[model samples]
Target: MLRNIVLLLLLCLIYSLEASDSDKCVTVNVNNLNDLVLKTFRPKPCMTVNINGSGKMEILSSDKFKTPLSNTPLAQVRITGGTFSIDPNFFKQYRHSLDVVTLENNNIPKLGYHVFQDLILRQLELRSNNILFLSNPFYNCSIYNLDLKHNKIDHLSDITFSYTRLFHVNLANNSISIIEPHSFPDTVITIQLSHNLLSSIGQNIFSNLFNLVLLCLAHNRLEYINFEKSDLGKLEDLDLSFNSINNLNQAGFSSLRNLKRLNLRNNHIKSISATNLQTSKLKILDISFNFFINFPHASLPESLNVIYVFGNPWNCKCLFDIEDSFSGNVVSNTMDCKLSQIVNAPICISYGGLCVDDRNNTLINAFSKEVSLYSNDCRDLLQNVIFDYEH
Candidate 1:
């Protein structure tokens, strides 16, 4: 009839190109449990499952993932370096069809209560395990990112992420000291808790992180921080860098006031009590290598645009009153002026280490340029000249 209608349209275009390459993703090497139920009969189902480094596959219980991902439609599950012991309803028959679950370098030490109940996950990478205990392991999930970095988690009880909808919670390095008060989950918006072994942090712990925006308590052992009675007020980046914070109470951070990048670098901060210098959206203020000799600079906040105050001990008249209190902002050379020392002229010169102005004794390369305490001359030095820390 026309060569049998062109051979039935070339066999229906080779069965629609083999059903679009069998619906795209279907890798497999599941080792045990009958090779994960023969990959759901391989006509198109599996959507990612690398049961990584499979040897000694110990996925004890949950009926070996209920008949192999019952009605397979999985969308990502790595289970790295196995020795797995994930029971508590091991993904309860792929509830709500998974959407990303890494389970890294396994040896999971703890995690029971509702181990990710009724899932709708969108990322749950349990990094380098040995997790020490964190009760409520996500229930009725709607998770949108929860890493749990380098585990060994110490403590963080109270309703730990109650009724989930998490936005991002890294928990860096871990060995967490403690944090019970409403454990976090006010639709979290970034929470790192860097390094860890937190020395202090209670003032209603973060009162319900009202949409917090980045709060990484860097390298911990924190000496103190009492954010004016909690409720992070939409915090915006507040990394208490390398801690041991010496002093900063004036209401610590006066409820953050939409803070904008305030890292308090290398701590033991000598002082900073201008009633907590309430941040009016501060813009970059590092307070490098602390132990300041003076730094209130008119209680800060004029929307500063970069202020590091190089490694402390500054007292060349408190760096000429922080160059007449941020004359017009932007200044960089990052002082060191040989750690400046001459409180009352004990013969100071310092060049490579800066500071040398005993009334034009010159050598003031305060890093080298970018000065303006009312148009430079290096801010007309000699404000009762001072500087001492040569020890």
Candidate 2:
């Protein structure tokens, strides 16, 4: 094991050195952008072009901002610092031999409608730009991964992402409130829409995405959900934690039959029904930190291997019953554990004494004392939470 670790460290060091040596940057300004194209921009192979103190980043413009490096093989381009306003046909010339493009930590007020039209890039990242609104920008591009997180985007117009080869799209950490119908195309596989202002979404917003798998809507203002309206039959992982959801349909994601993991923690759910899990393929479930008074009456899904249920006003009597049922033995342990963690366990048997239902709703302070769970995903007790923090 020590030898393996040493070998891995050596490989990491080699890779880091190679990566550091491959970067090529040129300090650019407005006046010298046109003059430095052939002389300083394209010589052999440039991995990255760092635009310092940017004003006009239209490097591939029509008149003077023509494609500078049509001969050299450029891998990536990152424009950082200052503010920029992109124009159409920005990258009209230098489209070949480009794999990734990033524009981060800049103040971009408006994105050119067809800046990346028909480009064959692999990844396009526009992070921390503080963009307020957006519409269908990409047109017939072969880009697969797109990142637009940490912006102030407030709305999503129809076909927000044009029909392209995009697979993974990240729109997290925005103040998005309105999402027009068919905003997302059917080609996307994963979409990150966490930390937004979505109180509700139209049923057909995700209707055409048949190949989507992972979807995150955590830290939103959603109160109700009817997944049956959403035709996401192939989704596997879903995150709905840290919301204001109080009403969930008992039919339980009629279209999410292939769902393996579900997170509904840190909400205001009163009671849940397990009848929907009978026909579904859920493996991990988290319903912690809610307003559950008693465990659901119906048995959990047989395919479930792990379930998280803690930090709620659970009736000790119900947990005892569930423990007896799960262990197939009599209930003996009545001491409530402050927090619980176990492997391959049924809905956890964390004790919290009698529930509000048992005491005729007199213990108002019991709800105030309910703990909040640390889990936001079913695969692990802790998630990265990068999408939850302020961006």
Candidate 3:
């Protein structure tokens, strides 16, 4: 019985020793990667985790503790479902692909300059983090898609995407108010900037994004959008709805040659006089829920299949005859006339084009009488009347 008890004690001791050994450091390294890659080697100050008596791993800051090492490479470390803060020097030293970096529901409060700079990453999803400012976030990253949405970023500075090739970026639902020019450099295909406080877009803001196809800026506070005269050459779909666009000048939309669909619903547009509009393949134009005293008379192409000009106070007297004569392929009868009686009036008798207004015959008669009395020789007649008074 004594020998059996001693054997049991030895086994327990051995198990405890094994467990302690297993709780030590684990290094990961990827071999034979490109020399110029950003994350080619293990990041010094990457992380140092200490195991406690209760089997809990505690991460120590660089100033607090040091980690043991055996010349180990760090391409094999898997840190999923755990809390780990990225070292500030991680991207500064190594510049290679950090493939499959998944940090779901992590609280990385602070990030340094060029934190992910010059790295070639396959996927990086830093969703649900409390990261407020990412200065030069992707200084030089070649990422496929970067989703930093749901972060608390407010201001976006210039060269934010210094040298990144981002395919799909979701910056929706943030407090981003100002977007200085050249904020997004290089090629970005799909960009989602919805649900923000972007009031204006300066010229050449989207000029460097040569490969952009889908640009979503809906649900913003944009009042003016002025694009320069360069062909947005590959743009397909653009969403500017749910905004405060009061006046859309010709300069604001000169170079959208390949644009297919445009959503301008729920805006404050009182008129639209488009010049050189036949340059685009616009199939859908939605101008609903606003004021439209005059819409562009430029004959829209036959490719236009849907036009939602409803819920606007359309002047019936001026536009009724024109809309009736128009041969456009699509028309939305939902455009309610503000002035019903004036809409049915003849267009030839009234020369000034006023979208239909209320049938205030008294005001109309007063205006016509003033015009007739002042017709042609009013200045001469005034002089004669003064001369008679002098005599």
Error of 1 at 70 (Å): 16
lDDT of 1 by residue, 294-341 (tens): 567777888878776654555566566566677788644244332243
| Model 3 lDDT tens row, 14-128 | 9999766654544332221111132332343232222212322323132222122223222212333333455555543334423544444445554556777667766677666
Off by over 4 Å in 3: 1-85, 89-97, 316-328, 333-391
Collision count for each candidate, in order: 3, 1, 22
Question: For model 3, where is the 10-residue window of minimal lDDT?
Answer: 382-391
As for model 3, its CA RMSD to the true structure in angstroms is 18.9
State TM-scores per candidate: 0.33, 0.77, 0.62
The candidate scoring highest on TM-score is 2
For residues 92-187, could you state the per-residue lDDT of candidate 2 as single tens digits? 556676678888887776676777777787789999987775655687777778899999999887766766677788999999988777788887
Sort the candidates on lDDT, descending order: 1, 2, 3
Task: Estimate every model's Cα lDDT from 0 to 1.
Answer: 0.67, 0.65, 0.57
What is the Cα-based TM-score of model 3? 0.62
Reference-based lDDT, residue 203, model 2: 69
Superior by TM-score: candidate 2 or candidate 3: 2
Model 1: colliding residue pairs: 337-353, 338-353, 342-387
